[model samples]
Target: MSNTQQLKDLTTQVRRDILRMVHKVNSGHPGGSLGCAEFFVSLYSDILDRKEGFDMDGIGEDLFFLSNGHISPVYYSVLARSGYFPVKELSTFRLINSRLQGHPTTHDNLPGIRIASGSLGQGMSVALGAAQTKKLNNDSHLIYSLHGDGELQEGQNWEAIMYAAGNKVDNIISTIDLNGQQIDGSTDTVLPMGSIKGKFEAFGWTVVEINEGNDIDAILKGMAEAKSKTGKGKPVCVLLKTVMGNGVDFMMHTHAWHGKAPNDEQLANGLVQNPETLGDY
Candidate 1:
């Protein structure tokens, strides 16, 4: 298969993983997880220059932090499929004493998780610190992070934005998942934070826009462009416009499924939309 087709297949399987994981638990975030399947698949499969194994102290290799940790289903699925851990462990997600909690946590020492996220607005600061550390150590690898657009409402993100630009933390590429929908409602209805691209540019970061965040080809091209823009005296930002629930027809473009699990019938329907490519765990 061609590279793009391979990525697309992986994305479809990841979407299936997301739906099955949440449905099995009857709890967990599926909307955002489904929406970001392409991003996760493309990043881990093609973009990152990762080493053979996982380590908390990720030195001399690309690192990624999931700011919107509610979508642990996708993160765990991608990491597992990428060989960070066994894919069978996905069946235990959200179960008591399972390393795969509803949201990612460091307390359990999950192999691929570097930080306990999902608290919102804190991941950028943590990524910045790591980026700065790479700079100090003369490490040349980059740091990447993903944040929900709604999460920008937190004051801490802006502070980190300002800090990164002012201090020239150019080794980080932060992306905002501009799905335009949050838990309560559309971001415009909940709390309209105007012009994410404008705000990032004003903060002195180089910004790129991906109008089709769900498309693997678009993500690959946009991320490559973002990488080219790095090391130019500022951090980079990718404004990714994505649908809340992308692969499943019924779930697409709605916030209702933000944290809801599918029933048996719904799960079956969703799986039909994305045929199992890598086999289900």
Candidate 2:
């Protein structure tokens, strides 16, 4: 199969893994996971450098951070599928003694994750720190981070943005899952972020908007454009417009499924939408 075909299959498999893992745990976030699967798949399968396995300092290679780590299901699935670990281990998600927890942490020394997250807004700071350190070391690889739209409410992210722009941390490409709905409800209803693109531009960051969050080809194009925007003395932010529950019909367009695991029936139905192109974990 072509690399593009492989990425499509990997993304479908990751979505299936997310559904099954979340269903088995009976408690985990799925909405955002489903929404970001394509972006993660495209990055891990096609864009990122994985010459070394889970290196903290991904020296001479690209790196990624999950700022919105509550979407651990998608991260874990992508990591496993990308050869960071055994895919079967996905079944241990959220179980006792499992390396996979409700949230991700580096304490477990998990093969793929480099930092602890899920406290919200802290990942951006962590990412900024990593980027700055890379600069100090004269590394050329770029750093990538993903954050939830709702998580922007945390003040720490803005501080990190300010720091990155002020210090000219230009090799970082961050993404916000602009899926509108959060666990509480619609993001606008919860706390409106008027003109997000304008806000980031005002903060001195280059911004790109991906109109189709679930389309892998579109995401790839947007990411390439986002990368080009980097290294011009500004951090790049991609406002990814995604559906809260992108693939599953019942779960879409609402915050009700944000943190709820599907029952067996729901899982069965959701799998039909994603299909098992690369086989479920």
Candidate 3:
């Protein structure tokens, strides 16, 4: 299959897995998971090298970190479907003793996940630190990190951002899910991220805005641009404008469903909009 088609198929399977896993556990943040499905698909399909399996230190391989752990559904699903673990393990999500916790953690020794990140705002620093380590070791591999727009409220992120720019941490690419909605309500109502692009630019980092973050083609294009900007002596940040719940209408336009799993009826309805491309996990 072509890279484009493969990414689309991966996204479909990811959406299916997200629904089934969340429905089984009766909890999860499907809204963000759905919103970022295409982004993750493009990352796993077009970027990153995992043929030798993932390592915590990730020597000689690109690394990725999830700052917003509530969206673990998409991360776990992508990792499983991309061959990081047995796809069947998805069924054990959120169950006691399951490595796939409600939030991702390295303690479980999950192959793909490198750090625990439910606290938010910390992953950027972690990614930056990891990138610095790679540079220190003279490794050419890049580091990637994902952050929710709301997570920017944490003071640590700004410190990390400043540190990255000041210290020339150019090998890290940080993408923010700027869906304009968090767990509470509209981002503006909760904490207005006024001129996010300007804020990043002012921080001395190269910034790119992706208006169609939910579309696979657009996501690929945006990520390609992000990759191009890497190693240019400045950190890159892509401000992704995504809908809270992208594929399903009822779940869109609000934050009420941000962390709520769909009931049986809702799951059935959502799955209707997204066909099972690689079979449900």
Judged by lDDT, which candidate is best? 1
Candidate 2 vs candidate 3: the lDDT winner is: 2
lDDT of each: 0.94, 0.89, 0.88
Q: Write the per-residue lDDT of candidate 1 for residues 149-228, one digit (tens) a residue.
A: 99999999999999999999999999999999999999999999988999999999999999999998999999999999
**For every candidate, C-alpha RMSD to the true structure in Å:** 1.0, 1.2, 1.2
Off by over 4 Å in 1: none
Please identify model 2 stretches exceeding 4 Å from their true place.
none
What are the runs in model 3 whose C-alpha is more than 4 Å off?
none
- Position 217, candidate 3: lDDT: 83
Instruction: Write model 2 residue lDDT over 58-167, tens digit each, in one string.
Output: 88888899999899999999999888989999999999999998999887778999998989989999888888888888988899999999999999989998998998
- lDDT (Cα, 0-100) at 159 in candidate 2: 94
Q: What is the overall TM-score of model 1 with all chains considered together?
A: 0.99
Model 3 residue 237 CA deviation in Å: 0.4
Backbone clashes for every candidate come to 0, 0, 0
Candidates ranked by lDDT, best first?
1, 2, 3
Model 2 steric clash pairs: none
Instruction: Supply the TM-score for candidate 2.
Output: 0.97
Q: List the residue pairs that clash in candidate 1.
A: none
